[model samples]
Target: MQEINSIYPTDKKECYKLILAQLKSLLEDEPYVIPNLSNTSALLNGALTDINWVGFYLLHNNELLLGPFQGKTACVHIPIGKGVCGTAVQKDAIQLVKDVHEFPGHIACDSASRSEIVIPIHYNGQIVGVLDIDSPFIARFDSVDQEGLSELVNILEIACDWANVR
Candidate 1:
């Protein structure tokens, strides 16, 4: 059985370091897609603080379909260029919004989400999915969070097989 050392350092950077190490252990030699995403979301949900939602939105056709997640029920589909998650894919960049209410076309899958960060996930030279995290407090995410989560997503990008994702 895999056991996560959930007790993380208060220092954000150190916390992420430990989180990444744990993720590597969990994903070692596992190339399957959905299970990896599911475990990743669960791991982040446990490691992160003050975040109410953490999940993935996979690219399908021209839209994003919700995949594995650890939170309340979410919007099943989001079009590219529409919400924060979609905007990340459309721009092919990270969307770190201090206040979701301030975003022009923010999609409120959870009304309580005040801040959000979306990172586009790439695989085999193409965008495959996204990592979407939400917090109830404004400005909950910052550059540190972005950098750390981005690294975590990078690990996901290489660890899972995307060709068979469905």
Candidate 2:
């Protein structure tokens, strides 16, 4: 239960580095999934600016089920290849949307979310879930976010025990 109230570094790379370090410290020796994801969502929600939602959706029985999150209530289930989160798993890549309104199949779980970034989380060479973040500002996410969050997801993939998640 560490308190993180310091301002993030102005430089994006430095900020991500700090975030990664914090994530490592927070997740160390904690191999359980739910609590890990819960803390992870809280960490990102507090660290990132202008984001309205920070959460995870896990793959189960061929669909994505809502997992731990930090935000207003969200969509409970999403089919594969459906929305940004699903599409990330569908394509097995990161989905960085500058504007959710512009995406053809965007799901509006929250109307305030104008942008989103979803990174597919992999385990044992298979997609297990997604690290999903949303912002209220249009074009809030970009390449820097994609890269930084991708690294964060990588940390989670390594630190958590995916086999025990479901």
Candidate 3:
């Protein structure tokens, strides 16, 4: 792969395509999960606009534990089937909330966040964590963002070695 470019396209879908490619290049030779996740969070935090937080919540001891993240201080633990991150793990599906205040049992890690997206990260047929992003603007995340971010998580699932990640 060529050098990862900083020039992001104005088109969302096209930008996502480039972001996926950039992620691949960034993780090309790395296998350890922690550093990979750290860089992934930083990459997304920088690449995506209109977002206040981007991070990972790893499943450990039947709950979600805070992992590498780029944003303000966040809640350290979230139970499964609870908040958006936990619900994503419980449902094993992406959660896209246009208005977090409207979502029952929402966890407000950052009071500035109004919208959020969470995608379950699976490895070897079991969920290991979630990729979460938060936005300060209501409805900041849409289907396009979900699709693109999902692809990013897919790459993370296959690229990192999750053994002993907890």
Best prediction by TM-score: 1
Point to the candidate with the largest lDDT.
1
Q: List the residue pairs that clash in candidate 2.
A: none
- Per-candidate TM-scores read 0.95, 0.95, 0.94
Sorted on lDDT, highest at the top, how do the candidates line up?
1, 2, 3
lDDT of 2 by residue, 1-166 (tens): 6546356776778888888998999999999989999999988888888899999999999999999999999999999999899889989988889899999899999999999999999999999999999999999888888889889989999999999876
RMSD of 1: 2.5
> Which residue pairs overlap in candidate 1's backbone?
none
- The global C-alpha lDDT for each of the candidates, from Candidate 1 onward, is 0.93, 0.91, 0.90
Which regions of candidate 1 fall more than 4 Å away from where they truly are?
A: 1-6
lDDT of model 3, residue 31:
94
For candidate 3, lDDT tens digit of each residue in 1-166? 5433356777889989988998999999899899999999988887788899999999999999999999999999999999899899988889999999999999888889999999999988999999999999999999999899888988898889887686
In order of TM-score, best first, we have: 1, 2, 3
Quick one: RMSD of model 3?
3.2
- Give the range where candidate 1 is weakest over 10 consecutive residues by summed lDDT: 1-10
For candidate 1, the TM-score is 0.95
Model 1 local distance difference test score: 0.93
Off by over 4 Å in 2: 1-6
Residue 39 displacement (Å), model 3: 0.8
